[model samples]
Every structure is written in structure tokens, then in C-alpha cells.
Target: MANIPAFKLNDGNEIPSFGFGVFQIPADGTTYKAVSDALKLGYRHIDTAAAYFNEQEVGKAINDSGIPRDQIWVTSKMWLQDYAYEDAKKAIDTSLNKLGLDYMDLYLLHQPYGKVDEAWRALEEAQKAGKIRSIGVSNMSPKLWKKWAPSFNVTPAVNQVEFNPYFQQQELRDVLADSHVALEAWAPLGEGNQDLFNEPVLKSLAEKYGKDVGQIILRYEHQLGVIVFPKSVHEARIKSNAEIFDFELTSDEMDALRKLDKGKGMHDPDAPGVADTLLNAFDIHAND
Candidate 1:
């Protein structure tokens, strides 16, 4: 297997450029097997969320994999219910206990709203106390970050958002770039949108490279310096997603993919009050 590169965080910590995401991994023994399989396939980084309700499964997989703790990178996020300072602290401890780890490689506030300032403060305190190595936010709009950033003692090291060829998030990318915060892409494959799979440009490039269209898309994103975590349950697809290191996308191919941007987001941020109502009404957390 080709080695994946690591990106240096603003705090000087390193994260694997390619990681495995367990966003919708079932909260059961299946999660354990899937994660263990990924680690055995040479993936050092694993991203999960409390909302996934499989932290314990992920932890069990890591522990049973027999990999040394320091060699593995584990990331987890806090949900909105735990946004208060004390509550967030308790959440972190619960995550640690569930993960069976002394410290987390990365911990992010899962959304942009709901006592976010308090959550950020708690993350900062966790870092100071050696419970977490790096801290960031997810699904945050630039406008939200602009209002929230000034209140922080620590700048966010990353912002996880929905990104793909169809929704490149150019404006948010620019804002994050200026702040020196890395952008991490969730749903990097557009949640398996068939249109993306059938794109002529991607098809041509995939044919040229003798790889799948998904590989071409991933290569493009890596070249653009956006971190990606494309999830998979099938062992073949899991292996294929990590095969991005073998090829490179040319400048023209990059440009072709860039033109596909529709300038819209598929997911909405769950801010407090009305935002939560909207998100709940739409069943934002429901698996598609």
C-alpha cells in the first residue's frame, strides 16, 4: 500500500491526509469489524462522531487491532446537546472512556450553533488539560465563524464541511484559507450521487488512469489540499478509496472538475432555536 501524507495542523500536530470516516457506520459489531479492517489495511486515521453512537465500537476495534495507541489517529466530535461548558467537558470524558484512550488525536464541535462559544471554550480547556491534541468545528458557515472566532483563545485547526466537485464551497474555502485552518470534506463523493459517477470528465480521466471515477474525484480533492474521508462498508470500496496515492490529476482535469461546482450545500447547519426546528423537521440526522 502507498503511504498517505500528513498535514501539519496550526498547532503543529500532524493528521493523515486520507482517513476513514464512520459517519453512518451502524452502532454495532459491524462498526468494529469495519474499523478494524480499515486499520489493518494501513489506515492510521479514523473519524467518528458521538451522533453516530458507535464510539465504543470504534474504540473496541482500535483496541483489538493491537496497534499501539500513539501510532493511530482517532477523531471524534461533540453533539449539540453537550454544547455547554460543563456538559462538553463531561462529553469529552465520556468519549475518552468509550474510546478507551488517554487522549484524543482530534475533537471537533459537531455543529456551528447551540452554545458553540461555550463548546469552543471547553475544547480549548481540554487541549490545555491534555485530553485532546487538536480542536476544530464542523458544518460552520463563514459568517458564523466570523462571529465565533473573535471569542476564542484558540483558533480552530480545521472546519469539516460538505465538499465535492459539485459543491466545492469556494467562498468557505477562501475564508478558511485566510485563517490558516484546513478544510476537511465530508460526503466527498456527494453521498454516491450517480451524476458525479457518470460525469464525462471524470469518466475520461478514470479511463485514462485505469481507475474508478471515485478515485479521480478523490485525487482532484487531494491536489486541491482539502482533506477527505469517503466512507464505505464494502471491503473493495474501502480499499479503492485509499488507492488515491498512486495517481495525480493534471491541471486541465482539475479545471474541468472545478467547473462542475453548483455553489450550493446539501446539508444545513443546526444553529440554536429555529435552526434546530428546521433541521429536526427535515430529519437532518436521518440516514439517506
Candidate 2:
């Protein structure tokens, strides 16, 4: 097993620096196998969510892998429909039941919308009851942070968002740094943007380091104190994504990659209509 690094959260819990995500991965056998392969490749962290609809498969893979539960880190989120106080409380239990776990290592409010205050209160209550180790929010902006920070009894341990070479999120980084909250990158590979892979700087860095463009981007973000979990169903790609800890990028090289930030991401939570679109678009609870 590779000696992967970990980042300490504000709440003092640590998360594996590199892991696997099951965002678009289907539930049927695919998520289970991908998660199993990732564990075999020494990935101790597995990121999933209620909206992803694959927690059962993830749980099955983890349970069958024979790795002790404490050796692995699992994360799930509360969906928009479950934002009410009671709904949020039940949602957490539902995730636990589906994942077949007694507790979750980390849990997040999936978005910045809905009855956020009520939902966050539920998360806090769950943490107190030992159902969740660390509680946080995803896709939150500074504005939204301000809206809820003053009222929060427990500070968010992390803020996961769409981050990549093209959208570095320097402002959010500074904000999170000030509060000692970890930043986890979701689209850390630029979601396979052709322009990003074809960029001269990234290409040159890959050549210099004898790695692929994906590796270069992931390593850059990792060096910047950002945690990343690049999702891929392919076994080879899952293995390749974990090969970043062996190399380090120098200051100038880090600066070169930092300059690629375009100051925006694919989805802007602060933007108008985004909340409505996300809140109304999906029926994640339909199959239940």
C-alpha cells in the first residue's frame, strides 16, 4: 500500500489526501468493482453521496474487502429534498442504512440551498450523537458562508467544490485557510477539458516529470494544500491517479500551473437560478 498523506480538518479529524469519487458511476456492479479496485490499489478514502445513488454498492465493496472499517474513510451528503430538520435527520440514517455502516467519517450538506439553517442543525445534532465524525457543506461561496457562519455552532471541516487547473478558487482557498477548513477538489482534472489537457504548460510539466497531464494537474492541486479524489471507473486510471505522491513540483512549476486559473468553475452556486435548478432538477429519492 502506498503511504498516502492526510489533511487534518478543522474538527481535528484527518482525511486521506488522495481517494476515489463515485459521482457519475452507476450502482450496478460498476461502483462496487471500481471501489473494490481502488481499495486494492491502496486508496483508503471513498467519496459518495445520497444523490449518487451508489452507497449500497460502496458499502458492499468496503464490507467485503476485508479491510477494517476504521482503516477506510467514507463520505456521504444530504440531498436538497432532505434539507428540512426532520428530513435531514432521517436522511443521515437512511444513508447509514444503505451504506451498512454504524457511522460516517464525514457528511456534508450537498448544496447551499433549501432550509440550510434547519438542515445544518440536524447535522450538528447527528455529530453530537456520534452518527457523523465531521460535518461540512459543499459548493458554498463566501457570501453563503457569511450567511451561516455566525449561526453555526460547529465550523465546517471542509468545503468540497469544482476545482481544477482552469478554476483554482484562490478566494475560497484564502477564506478556508483563514478558518482552517480543508478544501477538497471534485473536478480536479478539469472534467476532461481538452484545452486543459492540451495546454503547453501542463504538457511540458508532464514531459518534465514523465507523467500524464492528469497526473500533473492532480499533483499541482495536491501541492497547493487541496485534497482531491479523481473519479474513474477504469482500473488503470484509478491506479494511475494514486501515483502522484512520488513526485513534487517545484516553486516555479507550481507558479506556472497556478497562473492557469480562469477565476470561475462550471457551476456557480452564488449565481441566480442555480439553487432552483439544482433543487428542482433531480429526484434523487425516487427509487426509495
Candidate 3:
């Protein structure tokens, strides 16, 4: 397994340059085992969300790994119903209790819903109180961040989004540049998008470099300064994903991958039905 690098956050904290994501990990023992495998394979950063409902299992896996708490960086997000200030505050404690951690390395607002300002307020307060090391947003685009971020006392340290060769997020990066916020790529492998890894450009580069197409794309993102936490349950894949750091993607190769961008992927936070579906399915509330 290759060692992963850590990047500096706007808050003066360090974040792993690469990580393992537990988006759809089952709540059963599967999560514990996979997380344990990732840790043993040298993945120090693990990203999970409250909506995933596997916090307890992730916690157990970390505890069982015998890795010191300071060595592993854990991140979880606040979901829809937990957006209000009071709920967001409580949700921090809830996630902490579930994860069996003294404090999270990072926490995020899971979606763009009403009461987001209040949610941000809660995160800001928590950082001050030493509950979370850094705070950020997930699924928030530049357009959305511009509208509401003016009210934030502490600027968002990161914006985790669906990023891959397919959706390079050039426009999003332009805005985040002004705020100095990091862009963390979720589903960094396009979640196995055939068009992504199967592109002739990626194939040619992978062959040229004697690496997999996934490694080529991850290297691309790494050079572009986007944070990526690709999820995998297989031990082989988990081990292979960390190998990108050893090689460098040439500028020409990076440009070729950039041209492969289609700017489309699953889950658009700005889409019309997103809010309604979340509100109905999750019993979202704007109040504490």
C-alpha cells in the first residue's frame, strides 16, 4: 500500500489528499470489515455521512484497527432534518457519539436545504467549541455558495461534490478560488462510469503509464488539486487506489483527461426535485 498525502485546509488544518468513502456501505458488519481493510491498507482518511446510517459500524472498525485516534481522520455530514441550528448542534453530538470519537476532523452540511444558514452557524460554533476540526459543505455548487455564504462567519473549508474526469467542475473551481475553499471530489472514479474509464484518451494514457484508467484519472485530480476519496470494498481495489501517488501525470496527459469532461453525473444538488424528495423522504424540518 502507498502512503497518502495530506493537504492544508483554509482553517489551517491538514486533510488527507486521498481517502476511502463509505457512501453505500451496508449498516451491517460489512462496513466494519471494509473500513478495517481500508485502514490496514494504509487509508488514514475515512469519509461517511449521517444519512448513510453506518456511523456505528465505522466507529467499531476504527476502534478494532488499533490505529490511534490522531492517526485516522474521520468525517461525517449533517443530513436534511438536522439543518436547523439546534438540530445541527445536536447532530454533531449525535455523530460524535455514534463514531466514538472526541471530535471529527471534518463535518459538512449534507445538502442544500432551507435553514442552511442556521446549519452553518451550528458548524461554526462547534469549531469554536472544539467539536470539529474543520467545517465544509457537500453538494453545494458555486452558484448556491455565493447566495448564502456571505452570512457565514467562518468560510466553508471545503465543498465535497460529484467530481471525476466526467465532471471536472471548472466553473465551480473558479468561484471556490476566490473563497480559498478546497474542492473534495466524491465518487472520484465516476462511480465506475463506463464512459469515464473507457474513454480512448484514458485508455491510451493508462497503457502508456502502465497503470489502470482509474489511477490515471485519480492522478489527474491530484495534480489539479482536487481532493478525492474513492469508495471500494474489495481489498485489491482498495490497495491499488493508493498507488497513484508514486507517479506523475504529464501536463499533456492531464490536458487530454480534461478534454474528456462531460460535466454530468448522478445527483445534482440544484435540480428541481432534490429538495422535495429530501423533504418528503427524510421528514426535513427547518426548525431545531
Candidate 4:
């Protein structure tokens, strides 16, 4: 098993350096098998969300794998439909029930919109009640963070966002640093975009390090102290993603990767009418 390093959060909780992400993965035997394989291959952390509709399968995989719940880290998120304080409270319990877990290692607001302050308060209360170990938000920009952070009685422990070589949100990263919030990267591989995979600099680094381009990018993010979780349903790819801890990226190589930033992410959290679109489009219970 790989001894993945853990990064301590501002709240003094330790999160694994790498994890397995379950986004856009179907909630079926496939999810169960993929998660079971990841655990067997040494992934101790698993990320899922209400929107993904796979919490039940993820929980079952963890349980059936016979891994002690304490040895595995589980994270889930609250969707927009349940952003009201009371609704958020119910949503947290719903997620916990769906995952078949008593407490979540981390629970995040799935988006920056809706009743964030109310929803966050609910998260804080849950933490105090021992329902969640840590509480945070995702897809939140620095501007949105600043506007609401002061009102938070319990500061966010992690801020997950789309961070990759192609779209490094340096400004938000800096803000997160100042706030002592850990940056958890969601799409660390640029969603397998051909443009990112075909970059000459990344290819050169991959050849030099005896790794694939994906490994080079993951290693770079690991070197920058960012938390990364790459999603892949394939068994070979899941095993390959965990091979990053064996190597290190040099300062020059890291710099080269930084220069590939396009100064913008593929998704804009601040885009006009984004809240309205997301709120109405996603139904976490739709699959049921």
C-alpha cells in the first residue's frame, strides 16, 4: 500500500494527499466495483456528492471491502435544492443515510450559490453534533468567499475547485492560502482534454520521469501542496493514478507546468444566471 501523505487542515484535521473521485459515475454495480478496486489498490480516500447519486454504492463498496471505517476517509456534499437551513440539515442526514455512515469525514456545500450562509450554519451545527468532522464549500470563488467568510462561525477547512495545469486559479488559490483553507482539486486532469494531454512540455517531462502525462500533471499538483483526486472508472487507470507518490517534480518542471495556465477555468462560478440554471437543472433524487 502506498503511504500517501496527509495535509493538515486549518482545523487540525488531516486529509489524504490523494483520493478517488466519483463524479458523473453511475450509481450501480459499476460504482461499487470501481470503489472496491480503488480501495484494494491503496486509495484510502473517496469523494462523492449528492448530485452524483452514488453514495449508496460507495458506502456499500467500503463496507464490503472489509476496510475499517476509521481507516477510510469519506466525503460528500449538499446540493443546491437543500440550501435552506432546515433543508440543509435534512440534506446532511440524507447524505449520511445514503452513504450508510454515522459521520462523514468532510461535508461541503456543492456550490457557492443558494442560501450559503444558512446552509453553512447547518454544517457548523452538524460538526458540533459529531455528524461531520469538517465542513467546507466547493466551486466558490475568492470574491464570493470574502463576502461570506466573515459571517462563518467556523471557517471552511477546504475549498474544492477546478484546478489543473490548463486552468490554475492562482488568485483564488492565494486567497485560500491566506484564509488557511486547503485547496482540493476536482478535475486535476483537465477532464482528459486532448489539448492538455498532448502538450509538448508535459510529454517531455513524462518521458524524462518515466511516467505518462497524467502522472506528470498529478505529481506537479502534489508538489504544490494541493489536494488532488482524479476520477477514472477503469481499473488500470485507478492503479496508475496512485503511482504519483513515488516521484517528485523539480522546481523548473513545476514552473513549466505553471506556465501552461490559461488564466481561466472551463466553468465560471460567477457567470450570469448560473445559480438559476444549476438549481433547476439538477435533481439529486432524479435517478431514484
Candidate 5:
């Protein structure tokens, strides 16, 4: 377990730049074992969500691993089904109880859907009560930020979005920076998009640095100041994902990777039917 570097949150707490993402991990006992393996390999940050349906398993791994709670940064999210102010508050408590933690390092609204501002209000109150250290949103875009900005008293500490070489979110990044909101990238390895691994620029840099294309992309994003947490089911890939800290990518190499951006990635966060989809997805199990 080596010392991993951290980035300061607007709230004054520091978050490990690299974390273990459990987006698609099954909740059927696999998450517990896999996350325990990651913690054993020195990963102190674990990202999960109620939507992932693995918070209980993730919490089990963290607690069972014998790591001090303060040393581990745990982040979770509230599902759209729990977006009402009162429901959000209850959901927060439910997540805390499930994780078996007194406080969360970061808690996000899983999507920018349904009573978002109201949901945020619940998060703020929780933070004030010491139940949550930091609060933010996921799948947020600059357009959505504008509509939701006026109501915020405590600006979000982070905006986790779909960011990668193939879909570099430079414009939204700048807006978030102005508000001191750190940009966190999800699906950073292109969300299993093989084209990302096949990019010629990434391939070249990988060969030059004696690393894989994923490592090159992760290093490049870190250099760009974007917090990245890539996910994998294999122990080898989990260990390999954390190895980006050992190398440095030249500015020119970074620029070369930057050129690979085609502004393509996941769904638009501000799509017209988000609320409708949110309402319809009440029975959907995200990581079942």
C-alpha cells in the first residue's frame, strides 16, 4: 500500500485522485470480495451508489478489510426514485446505515433528474449535521448547471461526468473550475469502448511510456486535473489502474492525446425526457 496522491475538495477535505469505481459490479456478494481485494492492494477510495445496489457490499469490504474509516474515502449517490426532499433525506440515512458509516466523504445525486435542487437541499442539511462531508451531482452538464445554479448556497464540490479522450468535456470543465467545483470523470476508460483503446495517439504514448493505452489515458486526465476512478473486475486490471502515479506524460504527449477528443460520450445530462425516464426507472436496478 503506497501513498496515493489526493486532490483538495472545496470543503477542505482531500480526496484520492484515483479511486475504485463499482458501477457495474454485481451486488450478489461479488462487490464485497472484489472491493476487499482492491483495498488490500492499497486502494483507499471506493465509489459506490444506491443505484449500484452494492453499498452494503462495499461497506462490508471496507469494514472487513480492517482499514481505518478516516483513511478511506467513500462516495455514494441517491437514486432518482428518492429525489424528493424528504425522500432524499431518508435515502441519505439509508445509505449511511447500509454503509455502516457515520459520515460520507462525498454524496451525489445519481442523476440531474427530478427535484434536483430540492434533493441538494437535503444534502446540504446532512452536511451541516456532520452526516456528509461533501455534496455534489453526477451526469451534470453546463446547461443543467446554469438552470440549477441560482438556488445553490453551497456550490457543489464536484461534478462527476462522462469524460474521456473520445469525449473531452473542456467547456463544462472550465465552467466548473470557475465555481471551484472539481471535475470528476466517470467512464474514463471509454466505458468499455474499444475505440478508445485503439486510438493511435494513445497507442503511441503507451508504447513510449511502456504502459497500456488505459494507463496513458488515465495519466493524461490526471495531468489535466480531472479526478478519475476507473472500474474493473479483474485483480490485475485493478492493480494496473492504480499504477499511473509512477509515470509522467510530457506536455506534448498530452496535447497529442487531447486531439483525440471528438466530443462524443454518454447521454446528454439535460435531455428533454430525463425526468420522465427517472420516473419510469423506479424499478430499474442499476448494478443488479
Candidate 6:
């Protein structure tokens, strides 16, 4: 196994450059098996959430994998319904109980809406209580981040967003850069969008590096200092996604890939004429 690089967060904690994501992993034995397999394959970082409803399975995998709790980095999130101060705290307890862990490496506000300010306060309390090591947000726009960043004594350590070559968030990235906040890519492979896999430049680069187009994209983001959580149920891809540390992309190649950014989200939060659907999409029911 190769040594994956680590990024130092503003809070002084180090995060693995790559992690395994359990976004839609069913809360069954399959989830447990997949996560355990990832750990055995040298993945120390695992990203999950209360809304995912599979934290228990993730916990079971870690406990059964024979890895020390401190040797692994576990991250989970607070859903919208649990955004109030009291609810958020309870949610953390529920998550910890579900995962059977003493603490979380990082905990994030799952979205920008609902009672986020109150939820953020809960995150602060959790940090103070040692329930979570670092605090951050997910899917928060730069506007929201600016308004919220000043309110906390502890600055955000990270911002998880949908980042891929086609949807490179340069503006948000710049804002986070100024605050020393690290960025994490959720849909790093564009949610398995086939069009991205067929891009000419990616194909060319894949051939040059003797890697798949997905590998090329992952490497590009890695060079840009964005932590990526590429989800895969397949074992081969699980290993391939982590094999990116051995090579580097040149400046010209990086620029060519950057050109693929269309400046709009492939998975837009505000899709036109779908307000109800969009709102529902981020609702708690979607997770259930």
C-alpha cells in the first residue's frame, strides 16, 4: 500500500488526501462489508452522516476490522431537522452511539438552509466537549460562509462541496483559501457522469499515464489540494482511486483540465422550476 498524502487543516488536524464515501450505501451487511474492505485496503478515512442512516454499519466495520479507533478518521454530519442547538447535540450523541465511537474526526452541517446558525452553535459546543475534533460545513455557498465564519471563535476547518473538473468552484475556493479552510470534494467523479469519462483531454491524459480517465480527474483534484471522497462499490475502483499518489500532472495538463469547468453545477442546488423538488431533495425524507 502507498502512503496517501495528508492536508493540514486550519484547526491543526491532518486529513487523508483521499477517503471512502458511504453516501448511498444501504444500511445492511453490504455497507459493513464494503467499509471493512476499504479499511483492509489501507483506507483510514471514512465519510458518513446521520442522514445516511448507516453509521452503525460503518461503526461495526471499523470495530470488526481490527484497526484501533484512533488509527481511523471518521466523519459524520448533522442533518437539517437536527439543526437546533439541542437537537444538534442529541444528533451527535445518536451518531456516536450508532458508530460506537468515542469521537468524530470531523463533523459538518449537512446543508446551508434550515436552522444552520443554531446548528453551527451546536457544532461549537461539540468541539468544546471533545465530541468532534474539527468543525465545518457542506454545500454552503461563499455568501453563507462569509456570514457564518465571523460568528465563531473557531474557524471552519473544511468545506465539503460537489467538486469535479466540470464544476470547479473557483470563486468559493478563493473565499475558502483566504480563511485557510480546506476544501473537500464530494462528487469527485461527477456522480459517475458518463460524459465526463469520455472527454477528449481526459482520454488523452489517461493513455499518457496508462490510467483510466477517472484516475486522471482524481489526480488533477489532488494536485489542486482538494480532498476527494470518490464513492465506489466495486473493489477494483476502490483500489484504483487510491493509487493516484505515485504520479503527478504537469502545469499544462492541469490547465487543459481546468478548461473543462463550465462554472455551473452539474448537480445544481437551485434547479429552475423545481423548487419543491430541490427542497425535498435536501430534506430528511430523502435520506430515509
Q: Rank order by TM-score, top first? A: 2, 4, 5, 3, 1, 6
lDDT of 5 by residue, 176-279 (tens): 87888898999888886887888888888889889998888899999898899888889999999888887899878888888988976777877788768767
True-structure Cα RMSD, model 4: 1.0
- For model 1, where is the 10-residue window of minimal lDDT? 279-288
TM-score of each: 0.94, 0.98, 0.96, 0.98, 0.96, 0.94
Q: Please report, in order, the local distance difference test score of every candidate based on alpha carbons.
A: 0.87, 0.92, 0.88, 0.92, 0.88, 0.87
Give candidate 2's total backbone clashes. Answer: 0
Model 1, residue 100: displacement in angstroms?
0.7
By descending lDDT, how would the candidates be arranged? 2, 4, 5, 3, 1, 6
- Clash tally for model 6: 0
RMSD per prediction, one decimal? 3.1, 0.8, 2.3, 1.0, 1.9, 2.2
Model 1 quality (TM-score): 0.94
- As for candidate 3, its clashing pairs are none
RMSD in angstroms between candidate 1 and the native structure over all alpha carbons = 3.1
Candidate 3 accuracy as TM-score: 0.96
Candidate closer to the true structure by TM-score (higher is better), 3 or 4:
4
Per-residue lDDT tens digits for candidate 3, residues 1-288, read 666778898889999988999999897788898899999999999999988888989999998898999999999999877787898889999899999988999999988787899999999999999999999998887778888787899999999998988888899899998988999998888889887777998898889889999998888999999988888889899888888987898887788888878877687778888887886675422222
Candidate 2: which stretches are off by over 4 Å?
Answer: none
**Greater-TM-score candidate between 2 and 6:** 2
lDDT of 2 by residue, 181-251 (tens): 89999999989999999999999989999999999999999999898999999999999988998889999
Candidate 6 per-residue lDDT over residues 109-205, each given as its tens digit: 8876767788888888889999999999988667777766787777889999999998999999999988899999999999878999999999999
Residue pairs in candidate 4 whose N, alpha carbon or C atoms collide under 3 angstroms: none
Q: Model 2 misses residue 60 by how many Å?
A: 0.5
